[model samples]
Target: MATIPEPANATVQAVYRLHEQRDAQAGHRAHLGASLIGHPCTRYLWLTWRWAHKEAFDGRMLRLFEAGRQFEARIVAELRAIGVQVSEVDANGRQWRVNDHGGHFGGSLDGAALGLPEAPATWHVLEFKTHNAKSFADLKAKGVQAAKPMHWAQMQTYMGLTGMDRAMYIAENKDTSELYSERVAFDPVEFERLRARALQIIESPEPPPRISNDPAWWQCKTCAMHPICHGEQAPLVNCRTCAHSTPVMDGAGGWRCERHNTAIDTGRQHSGCAGHRYIPLLLERIAEKVDAWDEPGGNAAVRYRMADGAEFVNGAPPHFSSVEIRAAKHKAMLADPQVQRIKADFPDARMVA
Candidate 1:
């Protein structure tokens, strides 16, 4: 066998430079949009582009993300138990690297499971999904209907990057206490077709259209740029009398406006309405409209209404009685110098109706 020399730093640098050039030429963000969601709608594509570059997770959220990693570990263990030889490769330095031309498509597998014995080596790329049973059931009931285009494209892209013939999704539904697995195979022809579409979306000046097929309401809630992509609506403000209003759970927790107080079943678990209400103020300063009304028992209320049909109300206390005023006036009249000084401290007040 002939000895081969390790590549020099100059070669590695050249490779990296090439990768950057390809990424820039392909419009990497738009490429990401196409590969993930198969949609190039300007808003959706741009939102996805921004999300791919965002680092909004905190330490607490990172800890929660480790749960999925643990699940992946368990799935690896299971694959090893089934007599499959598993090993991780330094994919970044690997030779025979798969190139998509755009440089926006590549991923290193966690580990590749290879078959033994008489059968040809079957490369397996495993993906682990950990969720409560409710979520699993919802996805199952929807039958890929609820699956995000990005998710599907992600798995497919992995297969392409790794040159794997097949991939598996091992899902553990913690709530249902059940484990499920699904196998997916790569279709080179289909992969090429998708890749072309993605490239076209990336090169085009316009965005792709909104996917009308998605039925999952949860997606709408968690999306970061939802307010910008979606339209503005009502803002939720806390109120003492409204049933939807609740006290803040902790000192650190902000006050729960009425919009957030509604029960989950009532579709109020998230504060979209309240958050949307402030969109105009956040995006641009606008003059607010005010409306006033009188209430029974000499009380009054002021309403600050926004163009979006959202309102904030403040109520006034009842007026003082005539007898009460008369007694106070008499006491002030009969006061000593010191008492008179005290009475003077309490300036006369008038009810403004």
Candidate 2:
């Protein structure tokens, strides 16, 4: 039997639960942020932008984020004490916000600083980050460019949009209360490269390719959109990912499902129905097999090979040949030990074949 812990005061637990509930209700975002500029995988950014998968954080993680914000405020105060004039808002009385090559991509910078003897009172962007002892030490040693390229990209983008030439990068060690500050110069070449990357992500209809096929790659493991990128979590069932579904040749460019013999309206395609099936291409991309049958169709019943050369017949009585590929693949998937574990918790969690 599992050991049960003794109950403690309910007030703190209640507050944390309330925070989690509020965060969950915040809903999905529509645009990509400049903070993700240095992320290697554009597909991860695309999937997140399209809301293909959901991301969640537990109560403790949420509190950690909140604490980081508070740490920024403390850093700002310390800078002011040393005669560094920092202005968080712009001339119009709003916090400094910036964008990439196109206005469609942007993020709110931490703030901007002036009156620093190092920069001769020019308005230099201020970027603050909180880290633990180990992270803080590495950051201090390597500096922002080598230690945290994503942050470097973000600050550079901010500088490009706001027409600033430099920034004050600040880091605070949460564990030891030690601070490290560095002045980062803007690089026009790196700025253009980051902007081009953002444009590539925006113009592409399909997600960019995954960075690595291996799901266990350290970068992939820490990514927020790892499940969707690796195909571990089934993306929302849709006509785009279904083998039976295709775009109508008509000028209207509508969708249709060959199996159902019915026009698939936009609404139905966006949120797939119960009869949705997986495309063989998608299955193969996820490392699942869709082996072709070695034998020919006999008596109008087509046969297809599944994993390990297991043969399954299509067009046998009620089921049609169009769905044979998906049906066979689904059966093979369920037999896998890993999938069986998931089914233990969610008995109905079969692939939409």
Candidate 3:
């Protein structure tokens, strides 16, 4: 078991403040990076960088921020309406701090609410989420199936930090104008597991990779590393047996391959090669190809024929396969000219792949 960091102070309010600040900083970075990477797509690191730096915001980003604020305010109002004691609603007590790996981590919470008469005097650590009906439906579907690991881990992390046994997710579905309240309970066993995992992440030299397959286009489309991860000309392999297999168009702009199934017009990018061995040589080859494709008219597209006999155009499947290697396309439309320019200007950009 990894050593978990203890709160600097044992008081509920003290721990709450610390965890709140830490979460706030993390949330800020995550949102900023999500904005830059385009939502649903930005990686943790990208979001962190954008959040650390005060960059200019576009109208769309501004609207997103505004909507978030509005949602937060509404959650506060809901808590107040329920007659729960709301903390940190005022300016002075808004910020909190915690000890993280001997360094300081701080953030702010929306506010804490006490549950109603029917429920225990449980402290509700309220988390506000804004989603369209489609997104909400997706979540509900998953919950019906089984709680997602990430969501479970997230709520557990909050529980461990705040020492609260329960939390609530106040989700607003814009399309249906429906408010969905979901309650989550904390398991000490689960908290211990998450605490150990978080300690590992903090102690390790590298960050943990994002490990969800949520079919949200905004999540990947807005990722900063999408160009490197899912760029049209990126060198990838397709295999029928690999778990990452998805039907995708081949380089020839006709015929589909099962090995390449990941390229379907899902409107979202996903992590390919989940089980891929991180080989330097393979990475180098991919970098070289990305570089060649950056040159003027240097791009090529290949049409791949899949075992299913379906016709596909542009890009290969998400996985690498030993059973198939088909045609290559010289240039695909998805490859952006701006990206090519960036590659041309900074040859080292290939290393990012």
- Which is the leading candidate under TM-score? 2
| Every model's TM-score | 0.45, 0.68, 0.45
- Give per-residue CA lDDT, model 1, range 1-353, as digits (tens): 99687767777567556655554343222124323544424445533432222324443444446677787777778777888776655446552223353443333345666763223367666556776767778656653224544445556766776678776656778676588666667767767766666555334333344443242445544554454334331222212212233333232222344444443211232312322122122111112426545567533444444455444333432222222222233222222344335434653533222
lDDT of 2 by residue, 53-121 (tens): 557887878898899899889888988998988899988999898754344477898998898878765
Q: Which ranges of candidate 3 are over 4 A from the true structure?
A: 1-58, 89-92, 96-99, 104-107, 117-120, 140-151, 206-223, 228-353
Name the lDDT of candidate 1: 0.45
Q: Clashing residue pairs in candidate 1, if any?
A: 36-150, 40-207, 40-208, 41-207, 41-208, 42-207, 236-274
Off by over 4 Å in 2: 1-6, 236-353
lDDT of 3 by residue, 255-314 (tens): 122333434221121222323222112222132222111113322233333333322223
- What's the true lDDT of residue 195 in model 2? 83
Q: Which stretches of candidate 1 lie over 4 Å from their true place?
A: 1-35, 38-42, 50-60, 90-99, 116-120, 138-150, 205-222, 231-353
- What TM-score quantifies how close candidate 2 is to the native fold? 0.68
* lDDT (C-alpha) at residue 119 in model 3: 63
After aligning candidate 1 to the native by TM-score, how far in Å is the CA of 33 from where it should be? 7.6
